[model samples]
Target: MSGEAAPALGVLRRREFRLLFSAQAVSVLGDRMVAVALAFAVLEIGGSVADVGLVLAAGTFPLVATVLVGGVVADRVSRRAVMVAADLVRVASQGAMAALLIAGVAEVWMLALLAAVAGAATGFFGPASTGLLPEVVLAEQLQPANALRASAVSAGEILGPILAGVLVAAAGAGWAIAVDAVTFAVSAACLLALRVTPRAREQQSAFAVDLRAGWDAFRSRRWVWTFVAYFSLVNLLWGAWGTLGPIVAEQDLGGAAAWGAILTAMGVGALAGSLLAARVRPSRPLLLAAFTDSLFALPLAFLAATSSVPLIACGAFLAGAGMALTISIWESTLQRHIPGESLSRVSSYDWFGSLAFYPLGLAIWGPIAAAIGVGTSLWLSFGMAAAMTLALLSVPDIRRLPVAPPVAGEATP
Candidate 1:
């Protein structure tokens, strides 16, 4: 086949890619559902706004704490096995959460504890997932592979919340959460079935030594850490939005259904963006990605400024498109530039840096909003997001990082 004409769609022909893709598709749908279910469940149990923030923080903090260690372990052991174990843990956590809610015996502390377990599992899952993609797809197909993954997540985002709204309205948040539990089970089964080619094992080293190596790899790259620092601020704003956006919908906008609609619109936008990213190869991928990230602030600004659903949804759509584009390019960039052996560890550091303030943001947003109205808090979030993006643009490496050309005989999309 001609180099440029090799089927871009051929990546799906691989058994492992298909399995991984299906697993992520099912799991992300459940994750989106739980995002709605868990938020409403906190509210349903007579929990205050601050309580919702606390519960989210309870989950996120542990995930942040454990992710670096999880990354180290993933690099040492079977990545697939680590993912399967993580999926099982989430399955149990969500199952317990669902049962408690169904029995009308759910308490705030109980929910928080279960959420923490699930979050810890996610810490391991995220790094392993970042590392595992390179094992499944050709090096030349990394962009499309990442785009396909984004596409699966986008599809889930589109369908999951709408289903969650229906399930929560028709049955209860418990039933919606139960669906999340089932999806994890499905994900575990898919992981179990994947037959990954094992890589040459590195010599066993002390845990601290391995961690230091990972840290070195992460800090050595200016481009990697610069954006990681930027995203730390961005994620904080995201946490605030995730924590307060639903409250806004319930209080000012329509309700859960309205919130779901907004999320679905974002998903649709992300889906479109993923499709575009699969086809379009930018010369300065990082520069373009950073520029797009500034768009994230728009939805927050719109939400803060007005209660217009159409305008907010439009902003959300743009923001989602930007997010999908950023993620597709970012993952592909990392996979290409970082060595395979150290990739998971570096990814852990990336996750750790980006998520460092997420829990803090989640913990404080409710009280901040209470002290100075939700609208004001959202406006502040928008301001931070915009400022961070601009700061990232000022970094030379981030602004000028070009896509590495195709290697000899490697097909170009």
Candidate 2:
């Protein structure tokens, strides 16, 4: 052979990746359940749109604040341990919420507190879990591994809302939340059983030093920063739309059941998109993916302009398809381009930069919606998101960047 043969696709055929994927599927299913339960619970408590937005914003605040730090921790400690601990933390917080509701002592404040706790857990878990993928799967099979994970995530999204509806209708939102708590326990068990040994680093650095290292890693790349800047606007609009969409459905279009249908359509479309991404390779993944951001704005416009559930559902499906394509391409890009040791660190910057404005978007969306009226505020969000997506196309580096072909026997950069 002229050089070492590229790692086989058989790397994804390993037992470890399957176990990790299964664990993540279970965890994501639980997350979806909590998502539905939390929204419904707030509505059940007679909370207004503003209140729901505030609560949701509070829940995601930690992502903006601590996700980068979480990446540092993931780089320092055992990634698996970080994931397991985060799941256990979620179990405790969710269990408390479940108990409060079951005892008829539940308050909006309780849900808010638990949501904040869960959010904090996600800050740690997200970076660690993302950083661990390359540790378990060979670089050659990263695409396939990501596809499997996306399929599982889509399936969970499809199932979770249906299950939440059934549980909420039959037993109440609290019971649905309890089911989520149990899934966290299952996830913890799965993660606990995994065995992964980190490679020895040439030099061990302090936490602050490691954080700077991560920052330097990010600042070093123009392509990386360009995408980060673009996604900031993307997340801002996305968070606003997500915060307001269900409320629009429930208050104006139909009720929770209709909202579930819309959500399911989005999930099904995303599933199809993930399957498609598994087969087709793109050259400039981030640049190509950023174009999909505009598709999401149309759905926001539909919800803003009309009360027709079917039209809203169609728009949601289109938006979801775009979102899935963007996610798959972007994740694979990260895996292929970034160094494994620093992937989490870079990903943290990606996550934090993209999402820093999300809480503000969510927090202000409700009041803004109220002031401008839901319909008008939604249109404004749509316009803003569309403009941002088009603006990203003008970034020369983003448009010109090409895929790094796999080099046999060479370490990833």
The digit string of per-residue lDDT tens for model 1 on 182-207 reads: 99999999999999999899789999
lDDT digits (tens) for residues 1-413 of candidate 2: 21221222344468788778879888878777766777877877777787788778878897678898889988878889988998999999999988887777777877888888988888888888888988888776777678778877888778887788677667777888898899899998988888787666747888899999999989888778878887887777776676787787677866666777777777777777767667656777767788865577777888888888788878877877777777777788887888888888888898888888888888888888778888888888888887888788888877766667457785322
Off by over 4 Å in 2: 1-12, 405-413
**Off by more than 4 A, model 1:** 1-8, 405-413
Model 1 TM-score relative to the real fold:
0.96
In angstroms, the error of model 2 at 80 is 0.6
Q: Tell me the lDDT of model 1 at 219.
A: 92
Per-model tally of clashing residue pairs: 0, 0
